[model samples]
Target: MSIPLDIAALGERAAAMIEELGAISQSPDTLTRFFLTPEHRRAADLVGRWMREAGLDVTEDALGTVRGHWHPAGEEAPRLLIGSHIDTVAEAGKYDGCMGVILAILALEAVTRVGLSRPYGIDVLAFGDEEGTRFPTTLSASAAVAGIFSPANLTMRDADGISYRDALIAYGKNPDDIPAAAYDPDKVIAYVEAHIEQGPVLEAENEPLGVVTAIAGASRLSVTVTGEAGHAGTVPMRMRHDALLGAAEMALAVERIAKADRHGMVATVGRMHIDPGSVNVIPSRVVFTVDLRSGSDTSRRDALTRFEREAHRIAAQRQLSVVISAFHEVATVPCYPDLQLRLRRSITDVDRRAVAMPSGAGHDGQAMSKLCPIGMLFVRCRGGISHNPAEFAAPLDMGLAAAALVRFIERFNLPHLENNTTGAET
Candidate 1:
C-alpha cells in the first residue's frame, strides 16, 4: 500500500501509537485499561500531549474524554468528529476501541501538516468508556458529548460496589458538570469512526476495509434456575429436580434458535455458575448471562421472547423454577445514507475491493446517533479477534484505512457547511 509521499508517515505513527497505548495497561502481564481508573487518566493525559503536538488545541471533559480541535483556516467551520474509545475490555487487544482515535489523529495530522483548506474542521476525540468493562454502561462518554447522558446512569455501580458518581469524583471531575460537556451540534457535520473489523468477514472476503451499513442493538439478560438440593446417593436420577440440567437444556435451546434466524442474529451465554458443587450433592441453583444482538430491533426482541418462553417450559418440565431479568437494551443505529455514500466513495478510491457490511458489535456511534449522522470504516483484524491478548491489526491495513479517511475528509460535506449551521448537535 504505497501512499502519497507527504501523508505516508501517518501509517507508521498509527501503529506506534497503538503499541504505546497497549503498554499503558493496569496489569504488567496483559493489557487491561478501564474507565476512570489511573490508567485511563494517564491515557487521557498522553492523548492530550499528542493532540498538542499535532497542532490542535485540547480539552478534557468531566468524563475524561480527550478532545483535540483542529481548524484548517483558523475559522469556525463545521466540525467533523472522528475518534474511538481509549478504554478497553478485560485483557483487551491494542486496537479494539483505541485504533479509531489514533488513526483519526494521524489523518488529521496529515491535513494539518499540508494546510489543506476545507469548509469543515476536524476534531479528534478520545472517548473514555466505550468498552463498559468497569462501569457497566457503554458509550457514556460520547453520550455526554451528544447531550444524551442519563441522570440514572450515574447511579450504576461497578463490580467493587463503586457508584459511577463516586467514580467520577474519584477520577478528579465534577459529576454535576456533565452538561458542560455537551457540544453544539449545529457547529458540526457528522461523526466518523475508523476501527478494526473485530470480525472475520473482511478477511473472509479478502478486503482490507468495509463501510458499515448499520450497528446491531443488544439486549442483556440474567437468568436464574432454582431447584431443591439433595444428597446424590439418597436421590435417584429420575426423582431429583436438578437446576443445572434445566439450565443446560435452556442454553442449548438458545443456540439452536439463534442459528435458525436469518438476519444475522447472534446469541451468547458467556457467563454461568452452578451451585452445590460437591460431587455427591445434586446441583441446587444455576445462574447464567445472555447477550442477544441483531440488526433489527423487532427481530432481536422476538428472539428474546422465544428464548425466554422456551426456557420457562424447560424449567417446568425439569421441576425447577426460572427467572429472567433484563438489565440493558440499546437500539440499533443505521448509517445515514449521505455519509454511507461518501464512505463508499472513499473506500473505492483507496481500494476497489471495499464492501458494505453490518456491525454486530455496538459502538459509540449508537449513542451519538441522537446528535448527527454517523459513518464507520473497518480495517481487517487478524482472525477477527478482539478483547483479548492475541488480537492484532496489520500496519498495512492501518495505512489503507488512513488513505480512506483522508479521502473522506477531502470530500467532507453537509448541508450546514454549505449554508447555515444545522441544529440538533448535542
Candidate 2:
C-alpha cells in the first residue's frame, strides 16, 4: 500500500523545525553557526533526535555529515539520496539551507506512513559546513564525500588563524579520519536538494517554485592599482597620481562589460581598500576584489578577459600600475538533464507551467554533482533576500515546494548499472 502525501502535515513540520532553529542565537546576527561550533553541534544533535523520532537509522559521519536512512520493508531495494546543508552564513535567514533538510525529514515520514517501500532505499543528509562561515573553503563536507577535498584543506585556517584540523580536534572529531567520509559513487543512485530562491527571478515572475537547470560558475580577481601619492592640498588634480581615481575608472569598466553581456552575466566589486585612507591625503594604492559569474564557462571567461583588458587600458590612461591576481575559480556545473526532467515532471504534475531557471548561488548540490547525478528545487523567497535576518518565504510557497518534492521522490527511478547491490540482502 502506497502512503498518501499529506501537504499540510509536511508544511507544519517544516515550519516548526525552522522556528526551533531560528530561536538559537549563534552569532551577533544569530546566523553565524559555523561547523565545529557549539551551536552548530547542538543543531546537529537536534536533527539527529528528529531523525530517530522519524524511525530512521541515524549516524554522523567522521566529517560531521548526519545521515538518516529509511530502509524499505520488502525486497529489491533502491537507494535515493536527498539532502542539503544546515549551516548558515553570518546573519543568515532560517530558510536558506535548513529548509531542504526539514523537507527531507517530512518526505520520509510520509513515505513510511504509506507503508510503501521503494524499489530502493532512501537516505536524508544534513550536510555540515556548506556555507564555509568559519573558513574560506565552502562545501567542505560535501567535497569530502565527492573525493574532491584534499589533505591540504585540513590545515586551512580561519580569519583568526585557527586550523580546520585543530577545530575538528576541539570538537571531539578526528581530522585523520576525514577519509572515512568519502562515498563510493556506485552506491548513490541520485542526489536531490531543495533550497530557497535567493534571487528575484522566481518572485519577479510571480512563480512559487523553480526547477534548476544549471549552477553558475564563479571567478574572483584581486586587483591593485599603484600610483605615487602626494599631498592633497599641494598637488593639483591633473599633476596628481591618484590610484583611487584609476581604480574607480576600472570599477566602472567592469560594470560596462557586465551590462554588455546581460545574458545571465554579473560582476561585483564587493571588497575594496585604500591605503593611507585619511582626511587631506591622496591614496597611493587601491586594492579591490571583483566577483564574476555566468551560467556558461565561455561567457564567464569572456567577461573576465574583457574586464582585465579594460582595467589595463584605464590604468595606462591614468598613469597607474595595475596588477591582477587570481583569487578563486569555480567552473559552472550543469545538473543532470535526465534528473532535471524528472523534477520538471514532478513540478508539472502539481503546476503545469513550471519554469526552468539557473541557480546563481553556489550550493552543496554543485559539489555533490561531481560524484553522482544531482538535481535541485527552489522555493520563492520574499523579496529574494538571503544571507540576512529578514530573508523569508511564504508558508503557502513552502507547502507547495514540499508537495513537489514528495511527488518527485515517488516518481524517480534508480539505475541498476552497478553490481555493488547484487549481493546485498533486500
Candidate 3:
C-alpha cells in the first residue's frame, strides 16, 4: 500500500529547512558559503544534525561531505546514492544545490517513518565543493567520492593564497583519508539528484518538474587579438587596426554560429581584458574568454571549429594577429535510460507530465557518472532565475517533488512498474 502523501506539510517542512540552512552564510547580507570555510563547517554540522534526526547514521568524510546512511538491508547490500552540493557561489540563491539535499532528506525521512524495507540501502550525501568558488577545482568533493579525485588538485590555491591541501588540514581533515571516502563501485547502484531547473524552461513549459536528458558539454577558450596601439584621436577609422574591434566582431561570430546550430547551443564572451587601458588609447591587444555549451558533442565541436575560422578571418581582414587556446573542456553526460523511464513514470504518478530537457549548467553528476549510472530531476523556480537572491521555487512544487521522489524510491527495482509490487506500506 502507498502511504498517503501530504504535499503541503512536506513543502512547509522543506521551506523551513531551507531557511535554516540559508542563514549559515559567510556574508551578512547574501549567501556566500564556500568549501571548508567556517560557514561551510557550520552548514555541514547543521545538515548532520538533521540527518541524525531523520533516523539515519550521519558521518562526515575526509573532504567534509556529510553522509546520512539508511541501511535496513545490512551494510553489505548495494546502495543508492542521492545527493547535491551545499557550497554556494557569491550572492547565490538558496535553492540551487541546497534544495536537492533538502528534498532527499525529506523523502527519506518519509520512507523511514513508514519503515519501508528493500533489498538495497540509501545514502543521502551533502557534498561540500560543487561551486568551485573557493579552490581552483570544482566537483572535487564528488570526485573524491567517485574515486576520480586527483592529488594535484590539492596544490590548487584559493583567492586568499591558501592551498587546497592546507585548507583541508585547517578544516580538520587529513588529505590521506580521502581515498577511504570512495565507495566500491561494484556495491553502488546509481546516483540521483533533485535540483532547481536553474533556467526558464520548466516555467515556460508550464511544468512543475523536469527529467534531465543530459548534462550539456562545455568548452572554455581564451582568445587573444593583437594589433597596433595608436592615439585614439589621431588614428583615422579607416587606417586604425584596433584589436578591440576585431574581438567585438569575433564575439558576434560566436553568437551567430551557436544560433545556427541544430542542437541547443549557447555561447558567451563573459570576460575580457584590454591592454594599455586608456580612453585615448587605441587598445593594442584584447584578451577574452568564450564559454560554449551544447547538448550534442558533435555540434559543439563543429561550432568551435566554425568559431576558430571566423576568428582568424576577422583578424586577417582587420590586419590583427589572433590566438585561440582551450582552457577547459568536458563532454556531455546522458542520464541512464532505465533511470529516465522510471523517473518519468514517477512524475506521471504525481499527475504532472515531466518535461524532458538538457541542463546547461554543470553538476556533480558529471563526476559521479564515472562511478555509476546517473539521473537528475529538476524542479521549476520562479522566473527561471538562479545564482541570484531572487531564485525561488513554490513550496507546493517542492512538496510535489518530495512526493514524486517518494514514489520513485518506492519503485526502484529497475523492473516494469506493473511488475513491481513493493511500496511504502503504511
Candidate 4:
C-alpha cells in the first residue's frame, strides 16, 4: 500500500529540527560543530533517533556519514538516495546544510506514516564535513562514499594543526578503515539534495522553489605583490614602491574582467593582508586571496588568466614583482539532464511556477554529481543570506520544498519505501 504523504507535517518537523540544532552553539553567532567533534556526535545521535522513530535502519560509516535505510521487501529493488551534509561554516546560519538532512528525515517520516511503499529502497544520508570549516578538504564524507577520498585526505590538518585522522580516532572511529565506507556504484540509482538557495536568485525572482540546473565551479588563487619597503613620509609619490597600491590595482582589474564576462561570472577578494600594516609604513608585501566562479569552465579559466595577467602588468608598472599561487580549484559541474528533469517535474507537480536556475555556491550535491546522477531542490532564503547567523527561510517556503521532495520520492520508485516484511521491524 502506498503511504499518504503529509507535506505540512514534514515541513514543520524540518523547521523544528532546525531550531533545535541551531541552539547548540560553538560560538556566539557561529556554529562550530566540526566533523568528529562532540557537538557533531550529539547532532548525529539526535538525527539517528529521529531516523529510528521513522522506521529506518540507521548506521554510521567509518568516515562519520550517517545512513538511514527503509528497505522494500524484495531483493531486486534499486536504491534511491537522499540527503545533505550536516556540518556548517563558521558563523553559518541554521539552514545551510543541516536543513537538507532534516528535510530528508521528515520526508521519510511522512512517507512511512502514509504507508507509502515503492519498488526500490530509499536511503537518507547525513554526510559529514561538507563545509571544510575546520579541515581543508570539502565533501569529506560524500567523497568517501564516492570512493574519491584518499588516505592523504585523512592526514589533512585543521588550522590548529589537528589531523582529521587523529580527530576520527579520538571520536572512536578508525580512519584506516575509510575504505569500508565506500558505496558500491551499482547500488545507488539516484541522489537528491534539498538546500537553501544560498543566493538571492530565488528570493529576487519572488519564487519559493529553485530547481537547480547546474553548480558553478570555483577557483581560488593567492597573489603576492612584492615591493621595496621605504619611509612612508620621506618617499616621493613617484618613487614610492608600495605593494598595497599594486595589489589594489590588480584587485580592480579582477573586478573589471568578471564584469566583462557578465554570464554569471563572479570574482571576490575576501582575504587581504598588507605587511608592515603600520599607518606610517609603506607596505613592502601584500597578499590577497581571489575567488573566481562561473557556470562555464571556459569563462572561469579566461577570467583567471586575465586576472593573473593584469596582476603582472600592474606589478611591472609599479616596479614590483607579483607571484600567483593556486589555493584550490573545482571545475564546473553540470547536473545530469535526466535527474534535473525529474526534479523539475516534481517541483512543477507541487508548484506550477517553480523556477530552474544555477547554484553559485558550492555543495555536496556537486561532489556527488561526479559519482552518480544528482539533483538539487532549493528553498528561498531571506535576502539569500547564508553563512551567517541572520540566514533564514520562510516556513511556507520550507513546506513547499518538503512537499516537492516527498512527491519526488514517491514518483521515483525509491527502494527504501518498499515493505520489508521478512526483516526485523526497525
How high is each candidate's TM-score? 0.86, 0.90, 0.93, 0.88
Candidate order, lDDT descending: 3, 1, 4, 2
Q: Which 10 residues in a row give candidate 1 its minimum summed lDDT?
A: 417-426
Better of 1 and 3 by lDDT: 3
Candidate 2: lDDT of 139?
92
For candidate 2, lDDT tens digit of each residue in 1-426? Answer: 223656666677788888897665575447667888888788899888888887788988777888898877332354677989888887779998898898888777766766664667888999888998888788989888776777787889998899999988888888778877877776678788889989999999998888887788889999999998889899999888899999999999888887887447788999999988977889999999999877778788889888888889988988899999998988887766777788888777666556678788999887777777778889889998999888988767777777787788777665543222111110
**Candidate 3 TM-score over all chains jointly:** 0.93
lDDT of all predictions: 0.84, 0.81, 0.91, 0.81
Candidate 2, poorest ten consecutive residues by summed lDDT: 417-426
Extract clashing residue pairs from model 1. Answer: 185-425
Residue 136 lDDT in candidate 1: 68
lDDT for model 4: 0.81
lDDT of 2: 0.81
Error of 4 at 197 (Å): 1.8
Top candidate, metric TM-score:
3
User: Cα deviation of 383 in candidate 2 (Å)?
Assistant: 1.4
Can you tell me which runs of candidate 3 are displaced by over 4 Å?
414-426
Give Cα distance to truth, residue 286, candidate 1, Å. Answer: 3.0
TM-score sort, best first: 3, 2, 4, 1
lDDT of 4 by residue, 112-199 (tens): 7777767778889998789888887888788887777867877888888989889999888987788888777677787789999988
Runs in model 1 with CA error above 4 Å?
Answer: 1-9, 73-75, 134-136, 152-172, 226-240, 316-321, 415-426
Report the Cα RMSD per candidate.
Answer: 4.2, 4.9, 5.0, 6.1
Tell me the TM-score of model 4. 0.88
